[model samples]
Target chain A: MPKAPRAVVLLGAQRFDPTLVEAVKDLGIKGRIAAITAGWQEREEEDDDLEEHLATLSVTTENLRLHARAEEVFRADPEFHKAHRERQALLRHRQDFYRIRLEHALDAAQVIRQRQAPEAILEDEAHASIQAIRDLDHMHLSRCAIDRGEFEDRYRPLKRPALAKHRSEIAEIIAGSEGVAIAGGHVASLLNRLDLFGIAPMLGGKAIFAWCAGAMAISERVVLFHDSPPQGVGAAEVLDAGLGLAPGVVVLPQPEFRLRLDDKERVQLMARRFAPAVCLAMPERSRARWKSGRVESQQGGVFELREDGTHALSVARHSVPPMKGHVAS
Target chain B: MTGLTPLAITTLMMPGTDARKVDEFLAGKQFPLTEGPNVTFVWRGDAEGVNLRHWIYGLETATALSRLPHTDLWFLTLDIPEGSRIEYKFEVLRNGKGEWIEDPRNPNRARDPFGANSVLQAVGYEAPDWSTKDDLARPGTIDQLVFDSPSLEGRRNVQMYLPARFRRSRQYPLVVVHDGKDYLNYASMKEVLDNLIHRLEIPDVIVAFTDSPDRLREYANDEAHARFLTEELVPDLAARFPLYDRPQARCLMGASFGAVASFSTACRYPGFWGRLLLQSGSFAFTDIGKRNRRGPLFDRVVEFMNRYRNEPVAVSERIFVSCGVYESLIYENRSMVPLLDATGMQVRFVEARDGHNWENWRDRLREGLSWVFPGPLMFVYE
Candidate 1:
């Protein structure tokens, strides 16, 4: 079996304001870094901004073009493409059913918590409410896993010739590179491409840097969340089981824009519902590192949300570990 | 003096004030003074009677201002609602003659086809920060496409907004806008598109802005106009540009009469444009008779609206309607929402404290555009 990654660095939105350079410099990595921007879909090869940013620190960048590869695979194997579409439809149906249950459960929890009662009773009810949500989340996640597991069992897509060839090519690229950087895009697309290529195992022992959907794709479970959507009620839902590379953490990217942190009830509910796994809010320019199966370091408004609803993220810069390699010329 | 606004101090309490005090008060201050929901419009010239001339429906069009006893300052304080944007002009009566002019003291003005009016943004009313030009946002290029349309039997000019990072290899959602030049000039549309696209609030899109020489005649549910858009313009643009060949990737947007053009076009070609962003649409309809209060200009519009009301269909999948409460068309717009929603299409109607002008349409662009064609930001980012 492949060993665990050296460090799983999760950053915030890296489109307009990127902190990949700082993350790279801190890691003392000055060599070739493989990039997976499959989430960008048709615009997969548009990594000029990212390349330029990393180039400032003399870090050579290589876009793996997994999205393009997936397209090629689909074109080459129409049967695989049809199966993938069918699987996607199955997952979507499961999600719709799960949403119906999750919404009612979440509403019941909120109602119970807000009811007029004694302090002790209210506290107990709040706990129960959180537990109910957590239970539903676990149930939903398990059902999704079964759906995905069944599909994987039936298809055995990794054994397919096209995917296998690309996986080998990708593994070889990662082997040559020092680290892998994954940029943000549509989360579901990113997760799908990553799973299709089976690039998780190949990331072993390499410094893995990801942000936005990229960060979410690496976690044990991917949660789709937005506090205020334009049309519908914003509910956090379990998308699917992620790569499981970074465990015991629910990453919320662009929290400042996506979440209403001022609403204490909402903050408390979100934090408590995802207990055991720390609910980390990664705003722009924020960074959090997962090492040894836990968050070892964080900085730049990287917040650990608690049930109290306080939003005082420590702005003080943390000390960086000593450099192990010389600066690139 | 401790807790009152500057205008309140000068207008209410001061019994023995001079021109120096009034000049001092007016200096270095932005007008009109907006404190909470109350807006005080101040005029600093000598006149027999100064009236606030506005077009806000349901309110007295011409409201007289009270002059200070010792100074030439005339002021009128009206309790405006939060998030309401009103526009008005000052009708100064000098030497027994009334001369209408834009607010000399206020720099914020909104221009329209008719003329210009001074803008008053109450508390909680702010033009989206993205409406302004940002140096960081890479600007898009606009290319003109002049073509002869057999449907309309005339030559038409359309300007295209290609996003800063537009690539021919990638397919883009297209939004065809009516009264294109007016939006570009008055609404700062290019700046808005640049900023929204740069910030990822909306995807990189190909916007086709179209104009008509005779909008009143052409845009009022004209079948030829509809044909020109659905047949002539859209197909031509699709062939020229890399556009997604699906209804969900297409949109038609306009304001007022322009909105009538978009609505009628979509009705003509149902399921062709998946989204419709209609702002203050001139959807004039009567419950009984064919005549409308908006007069002869809205005859064709009212005729079409009446017919659609009788037999409404789900022309598009989603629609975004925004109308200013201050405009005369608010009632028509408000009534149309339920009818549109009942057609089984997803409908969103937004009402602003504004009037029927370009700026009112401009202010609601973020909400209307983002909902219709959301970018990567609106997607699930975990």
Candidate 2:
């Protein structure tokens, strides 16, 4: 039997989109894949447990990776390392100062606890914890070496090696596979960096699959909704860039049943706000597949957002014909 | 202040007797009753076979008072606004005349902030449900269990609520809610979970409601509270139940002070929680003293966001944030939601119609839960 294709899932701040599983299954792949979480600072024990869970889920463990970008090495260089070390030392010192301040706070808390009862103590503990972390984060950032403008520029180069390594490993896993599925929202960021570093030509002849943030990142432009000054990452920064691998803008997965009626309205508004961008809104557990730019409903129905801002939904039927291709100019 | 005089009077009514009943009886006797700071009555009563004019004022709040006759009236003049409703009870003298009574004008009553009992009325707002009965009595499947500060036993209350399809044997994702009383019961959180679970909107998950009574003092101080959770609570919960035994299966949630706790805890510990639900969090409280005195907590929250802006966060840990348009803290919550998202956390922002009350918090629970547990619905039939 042929070795199954391997995939990488870049989780968003929310839960994983279930449609990725279906997309993978449809691609005739049956192998364990790695789920890489890239955003937050994690506790060691928790990180270990998460790795164990993903491994249990059959994702390849040997190659499981984190975003240990080469920037750390650059920052650690002797010339730059001094500034970094000094900043780190300052952060550590400030943290210690705050910890002492907390002793006074704890003492006050004890008095309140004595008067109020056990519950008061619990509330006090939670308050103290939140304060300490907030203080620590503030202390660390005030001492960071890079400014926002310089940081963004420098950050681009730093991402290249990480993406190259990820791609090479993925290439090895899916050596002879006809198609590969890249599940996750952050995958687009990796794809974009790959194109920037001129690594896209290296993985020729392989079909690409993307969903949620993964799909959004691979499109002509990845829309950053969560960003205040909405950012758009282009094909160079977005790895899949229609990958010529598929067509049409992938509507990332969202929630199906919104708690508030306004939530649906907000999502629709987002789609409208990005008009002519071929906005695709995939609800949780649902998916949309694009072949050669023409979108088709798969598992989940496809909703076409017209230029007039009106949306049309076509339900999924067993006898539906496969969608044709249309190039995004 | 001309009429202000220190007066002392003690009245008693029979136990278990409604004070209002006596007031009604006195009303029929053609006595003049005036209620201000207390209930005062001037009535003609026969004393030793001679008719005498008597005055009575109820200074204490009582449902029942000891019965007495020939009461001596010690009247104190007090300046009170007209139409003001006060609560008081009358005291009887040695002469068997006056008895304790309730204020007729103000039937509603409330507890005074001070230790001494006084007369007042209920503010007409609905009181929180303090009844400790668990309507859903069966032990719920443990999705995630966290125990913080084991050495401080009995000081904490471990609260657990199972999703609609909860079962004893099945392991589920655990979302731990800080300020458990406010989130689970006071906010009608269980109902939100039930609706989401039943609709297949969100995946089946276990919710551990951790009590945080001293929230203001502890949550934002030293992460000692988070340590209690990560070190103590997680271990204790894991051992006792079949919860999702991994960090990816764990989540943390809170609002206001609780919100700061949830965000700070997750950021500090990172992979410990896969999801975070924060509503009207005070993210901007930068200076603790200033925040405690006059500044809103949002100042500190902004400091937290700026610091962690580029830190590698649990990119996989999803976050849901909501705030009422009328709530003063909405701006902070809104700004933090995107900040967390920019740092690579999955974040959903929501705006509601209400304020920072249980009603709005209750509504956000279902939406927030669904965001964290989006997957195929699994129903556990009892």
The best candidate by DockQ is 1
Chain A TM-score values for every predicted structure, listed in order: 0.92, 0.45
lDDT by residue (B1-382, candidate 2, tens digit) is: 1235322122223343344544554454321233334333332222322221111122222222222343422223343334332333334333765544343333333322121212322122232231122454222332333344554443676777766455564567777788886665456566656655544445567777887656775676336787877777777777765786666578888887788888788777867787778887766633233343335544455555556543535534577888866566766667666667666566778885445555557656656766666533211100
Candidate 1 lDDT for residue A119: 97
Q: Which pairs of residues collide in candidate 1?
A: none
TM-score for chain B considered on its own, for each of the candidates? 0.94, 0.56
Which portions of model 1 show Cα errors greater than 4 Å?
Answer: A1-165, A176-189, A204-209, A228-240, A268-278, A283-329, B1-25, B44-48, B67-72, B94-97, B379-382
Q: After superposition, how far is residue A245 of candidate 1 from its true place, in Å?
A: 2.1
TM-score of chain B of 1: 0.94
lDDT of candidate 1 over A1-329, digit per residue (tens): 55788898999888778889999999999899999998888788988998999999999999999999998898888999889877876775687678667877887886786689999998888788778778888877777767767878888888999888988899899999999998888888898898888787788889999999999888777788888764345778778777776677777898977888888877877877776666778899999887866677888888867778765574323223211110100
- What DockQ was computed for model 1? 0.28
* Candidate 1 residue A279 C-alpha distance from true site, Å: 3.2
Candidate 1 C-alpha lDDT tens digits along B1-382: 2246454544544676888888777788778887677788999888999999998998999999998787888998888889988889999999999999999889888887777889988889887788999999999999999989999898999999999989886679999999999999888899989998887778899999999999999999899999899888989998999997778789999999999999999999999999999999999999999999889988999999999999999999879999999999999999999999999887889998899888988888888888788665655452
Against the true two-chain complex, what DockQ does each candidate achieve?
0.28, 0.02
Q: Which ten residues in a row have the lowest lDDT in candidate 1 chain B?
A: B1-10
